[model samples]
Target: MTVVVNHHGVSAADVLTVARESATVSLSVDAIAAMTKSRSIVDSIERDGRPVYGISTGFGALANTFISPERRAELQHALIRSHAAGIGAPMPREVVRAMILLRIRSLALAHSGVRHIIVQALVDLLNHDITPWVPEHGSLGASGDLAPLAHCALVLMGEGWVLGKDGHRINGGDALMAAGLTPIELSSKEGLALINGTDGMLGMLILANDDLAHLCTMADVTAALSIEAMLGTDRPFHPSIHAIRPHPGQGLSAANIFRLLQNSAIMDSHRDDFEHAVQDAYSMRCAPQVAGAARDTLDFARGVAARELVSVADNPVVLPDGRVESTGNFHGAPLGFAADFLAIAACEIGSISERRVDRLLDVTRSRSLPPFLTPDAGVNSGLMIAQYTAAGIVAENRRLASPASVDTIPTSGMQEDHVSMGWAAAVKLRRVLDNLTSLLAVELLAAVRGLQLRAPLQPSPAGRIATEFVSLFAGRPGPDVFLAPILEHARATISGRDLRQALEAEVGPLA
Candidate 1:
């Protein structure tokens, strides 16, 4: 289905579909009208020789320097060329696509004083599968992701390179010509409008938010599997237990665990074991608290993402009454905060999962399960190293979760003294999200192996389905084989045929 961007603005979900699912994109009639009206205002400002901060005057510290009309277009050209200073690894294909889609959506708000053709060019780039080679570095998150967006803007100007449909590198001009598209001729303030916004970090935020939301849900699913494998109890997840501190995410996570473990012979087998401890370890018992809090953190992040989706993050906003104003809306502090918070939340989720993996590998702690779930514990070493892999990622996540927002160095000769290190925050959040995926996969494999060792006694109705689903690619209980293939299967389960989704089909959606 086609997604529309109008004067009223777009939503985060729409961006995801267009960016990730390859949905078709189009500009709204209202958006075209808004852009036309806003563009006319800029023309009038230039005609009247109004010293608009970004229109007729220089940018940043040189805001007082005015440019003549004849030189205005060159100003834009020079602005994009100079600001496209990003140098590092190219951004992920999905992220670049998202950046383009988001920049278009924000422009669709009709406050950036850009022509409709410019927005349409971005749409055509996406429709034609033309992705610019945007770099991974160079954005302060203030002045609206200037460096990252500039690289994107460079493609629109036909001055840079792009990755084609075949994933081959091609010059931006050549790509545009091949797709029957043409480069943009920047107007007064057009370059600034194109490059000034939180699209870079916002794009990453959207992707991370979507991934982390699913990860948080899957985190619960794996935790349930681990709990059962460890002979842990689900009583702590009862609604009555969570009633006093009722966080929506917590309740949802608890309810999910409670339902997933229903009718489990493994849990029931130890239900009346007087010799067994009444409570389980914190890693097993506090699953809901950690996973639910991650869910809640994402809830807040989504709110911010939604706001950014509909916002006009241009440096100087254009109003309907033909007024141009400089504003700080382009700062990415909100997104930076969301990204950092998600990193911390994802880190904690992985941290707990690693603990569960360690317990499963230890013979004494794993109940009756074989050591490392391997037939020959000492000779094979089993999943002993898997825990170490997970632990390594967990420690890296701690560093990724260091809150990039807390520290900022002055840039632009301190003209932008207090910058929001939001771009860094968003970038690291993606890494944290990736690391969490692998970490969760490692835990899933361990838990599935533990459940397999408990064979004769079946898992819960829900657990049985989850285990069976993973077992297809996981193979049966035995000595270690190619662990990468096993982990790949686990990652695919959570990413594609999600264990939670399978349970939801039978028992309904979890929290």
Candidate 2:
């Protein structure tokens, strides 16, 4: 499927389909026309000898200087070459694709005053799968992710490195030539128009936002399985309790849990049984509160990202009346704060998941289950080491959750002072995602094991489906058998398949 880029309106789902599902991309002809008209205005202004920042004049820190018309092309080339100072590991191919799409979207807004040829060059690269090698580091997130985006601009001029369709690194010039493409000579403000934006930060947020949304749904499913495995009371998920406060996420989560556990023979068998009291521990009882808070965090981040995706993060925008005006749409504080919030939300999911895993392993807390859910206590370690591993990740997630937005260091001679370390924040969120995936896998494994012990007493339809899905990958644990396969199976079960979709197909849509 061809994913269309509409500058004014792009959805998170579009990003996921293109980035993950290998969807083709195309830009609208109307968008190109709009950009060309804007560039014509900029050209008319320059022909009449009007001073425009970075177009007729110079860039930041050099804004006081003026360039002669004869050196305009040289100035544009020099800006791209000078800013192509990005270092460190190459960013993922998906992120590079996202950056390309976002940059094109921003230019499509007709505010950046870039030539049509430059926009076409970007679209050609996307269509031909020529992904530029952008470095992960070097963006302070202020003044529009200048350093990293410079690498993208360099590729348009055929001056950087790019991965070809065959996945081999080659000079951008050679790649463009091999694909029957010609290098674009940036004109006037074209170079600045390409690189001067928050596309880098916005691209990262788009990917992270999509991942976090899926993770939120998975968290609710895992929590439901854990609650049933513990035979916990369903009173915590009662509608009356959540109706008083009515936080959308909390109420939605409660409704989901209640639906998942409905018509369970195990719950019916234990409805009148006096195991302890009316409630389970906070980890089991307050699952909605912990997971719902993460849901709310995702909602907030989505709002910020939606606004940023449609914004023009360029400088020296061209007006309809043939005038140039410098502005500050390139600041990344909004994206920075949103990425930090996503990091915190993911960390909480890991934190609460680890605790639930701990409860499943504790002999006293787990009731009839053996210590660490092992068939034999002293002979085999069972899931004892798995809990330790989950705990270690939980601790690391807490450390990764530290807000990268709060800290900043002066760069570009302090002219670009007060940066938003949004790159760091986005990278940390990716780490949290990896850790949470593994942590939840461990919980699912333990929950399945505990559910096996309670067999003959049937689980809810949702829990039954989860049990069968997990059992397909993991088998019943036996004494003196190596558990490496079980752990691997559990990891594959959670990470390799879309658990939420599978459950939704069986139980209908979740709240």
Candidate 3:
């Protein structure tokens, strides 16, 4: 199905499909008309002889310089050439695609004063799968994502590198011609319009939201598995027990645990036993509250992304009243804060899961389970170092959670003195999500083994689904096999939703 950029907004679901699932994209008719109308205003301004910030005049530190109409197009091209200064490894292909897609969506607002043809060229680029080689670094995220967006604009001018559908890097000019697309000659304000906005950081923020959403649900599922594996009771998850505090997430999590334990001989075995611990640890007991907080944060981030999708975050915005004026709508502080908050949330979710992993591995803590969940604790170290791996990843997540928005260095002769380091925040959040995926995998790996040792005693039906899913990678646990493959498979199963679906099909959907 095609995702339409109606110039009103795009949904987070639409962004994920186009960015990662190769979904088709198109512009709306009204958006095309708006661009044409805005383009006329720019042309009128050029004739009126006023030194518009990006039309008849220069950019950033050179904002005071005026350009003759004859030289205006050259000014635009030169601006793009000088600003495409990003340095580092190429950004992931999906991210580059998102950057292009979002840039087009913003331009569709017609506030950037870009010609409809330029917007169409960008659409054609995406339609033909001509991904620009935007660098991983080089965006302050205020004054728009200037450097990275400039790199993209450079390709439209047929002056940079692009990755073709065949996965080979080729000259941008050649790639454009190969795809039957032509280079664009930027008119007054087009270059600034192209480079100025928070598209890059916003793109990453949307994708991270998608990842963290599913990961939060899996966090609950895995925690439930761990509870049954250790022979812990699910009584603390009772609605009556959680209703006093009444956090929506807590109640939802408690309900989830109660439902997931359906028809379980293991939980049932403990139902009558007065000997079980009076309560589960905070990680198991409060799983929903922590994961729920992340859910609340995701809701906020999605709201921000939705607004960004429709809002005209351009410099020198074109208005329907026949006026074009420079504005500060390009700042990315909102996206920056969202990215940083989600990073912290992901880190905490992983941090708590790592603690659970350690608990399952410790004989003293694991109660009846064998040490490290290994059959012979002495002969096999089993998952001892696996917990270390999880701990190390959790440590890295703590570092990634450091807010990138708090720090800034001035650029453009102090013209852009207080920039948002939102690109940095977005990138770090992606890493935190990846690490969380791995951390959860390690905990599930240990939990699966713990359940195996419980044998003749069965886990809840929901837990059996989890164990069954992991069993595809982790069979009956004995001594450690090649551990990396198991971990990889486990991470994939969780990230890919196979683990969640396996359980949900039986116990119904989780919160």
Candidate 4:
């Protein structure tokens, strides 16, 4: 698949294809024409010898310093090399790819005053599967993700490190040579244009938004299974119950649970029994409310990402009338807030899931099920420590939930005072979502075992299919064995999407 880059902006799906699927990228003829037109204005400005913030002068606190025309190329080169100061481990290939794609998208909009070949060079990197080695730090999220993007721009100059298509790290110049490509020299305004944007944070946001949406449905599925395993009522999931208040996410989640539990013999068997509690505990009864709010929050984040997708996060944007004006579009407060908000939402989902896993383990709380769902009782520890693992992750997620956007520190000689810290928020949000995936996997493991303990009483059709799918990786439920590998397999199942796909096949699409 080839994603055509245009000034009209790309969709989140298009970004994912280029980022994850290794889909090649191409610049539209119109995008190239737009770049040519914008570059002329920059050239004209350079010849007139008027000091432009990015064209003829140094950046940030150094903006006051002016450079002669002969030295402008060196200035752009120095900007990329010096700004390439990110620290810590290299970012994943997909993230670097997404950042490159988004940067191209921004430049292709013709507001960044970069040449068409600059956009084409980035396109070549993506097409050839040459991913730059971008370290995870060095952006205040106010002056854009400068350090990270600079690392990427360094690759365009053939002077950084990159992972080749074969997944081996190589010198940037060597990688370019191997791909039969030539590096371009940075020109006036081009280096600043490359590094100045919120592409890194925005890319992470779009990826997390997609992952969390899928997890929301997966949460509903697991919540239903947990309800059946615990002998809880499904009354709370009724469509009418959610209709009165009617948040869109709430209705969708309730409908999913309601359908997942339909034709469930376990639920039907308990319907008439007065012994069964009239109501379930909060974890089971209020599953939709917690998961629903997370879904709603994800929707809000998606909206923010959508708006940012088309925005020009650059300084000194070139106008249609050929005016280059500095603007605050590079600020990352919006992306930072969205990423932080999502961390809280994802953390809450894991928090409630931990509660459900706890209930399935405790003898006093799990009703008729064996302690920790182990038939041998004290002879086998069962899933006791599994609950402990979930608890640890939940605690960690709670700490990660603290908003990174609220904190700020000055950078660039205090010229960039009151930093957004959005890059920090984005990085932490990735951790929270990953933890949520593990947390959900743990819940699925316990709930599947609990359902098996229910035995002769059949689960809902969807639940039975889920049990079978997890069983392939986890093996038949029995006395405790070497559990780490089993748990890893179960995590793979949740992350792999096979379980959800199988259930949806049985019950149709979830919300």
Q: Indicate which candidate wins on TM-score.
A: 4
Q: Which candidate wins on lDDT? A: 4
Lowest lDDT 10-residue stretch of candidate 4: 161-170
lDDT at position 438, candidate 4 = 92
lDDT, candidate 4, 407-444, per-residue tens: 99887788888778888899999899889889889999
TM-score of 4: 0.98
How does model 4 fare in lDDT? 0.90
| Per-model RMSD to reference | 1.4, 2.0, 1.4, 1.1
lDDT for every model?
Answer: 0.87, 0.81, 0.86, 0.90
Q: Work out candidate 3's RMSD over C-alphas.
A: 1.4
What are the clashing pairs of model 4?
none
Residue-level lDDT tens digits of model 3 in 1-511:
7888876757778778889988888889988888898899888898889778888888888889888989999998998998888888788888888888899888987888888888888888888888888887889886979999998999999989887656666899998898888999988888888989999999999999889988888888788888888777877777788788876766776787778866778777777677665777887777878887888888889899988888889988989898888888898899999999999999999999998889898888887788888988898889999998999999999999999999899988999899889999999999999999999899888888888888888887777777888887789878768899999999998799766777778888887
| C-alpha positional error of residue 498 in candidate 1 after TM-score superposition, expressed in Å | 4.5
TM-score of 2: 0.95
The sequence of per-residue lDDT tens digits that candidate 1 reaches over residues 372-472 is 88988777878988888899999999988999998888877678888889999999999998999998899888888888888788988777887788779
Residue runs of model 1 more than 4 Å from their true location after superposition: 165-168
Candidate 2 per-residue lDDT, tens place, 1-511, comes to 8877754645667766766776777777787778888988888877887777888788877886889999998999999999988887788888888888778778878888887678778878878778888877888887877888888888888889986656666798988888888889888888888888888778888888777766666777788888888887787899999999788888878888878878877778778777743868888878888778888988898898888877777898877776678777787888888888888888988898889989988888876678888888898877899899899999999998989999999876667778888777877788888788888888888888888778788888888888888877676766745666877777666665466677788787875
TM-score of each: 0.97, 0.95, 0.97, 0.98
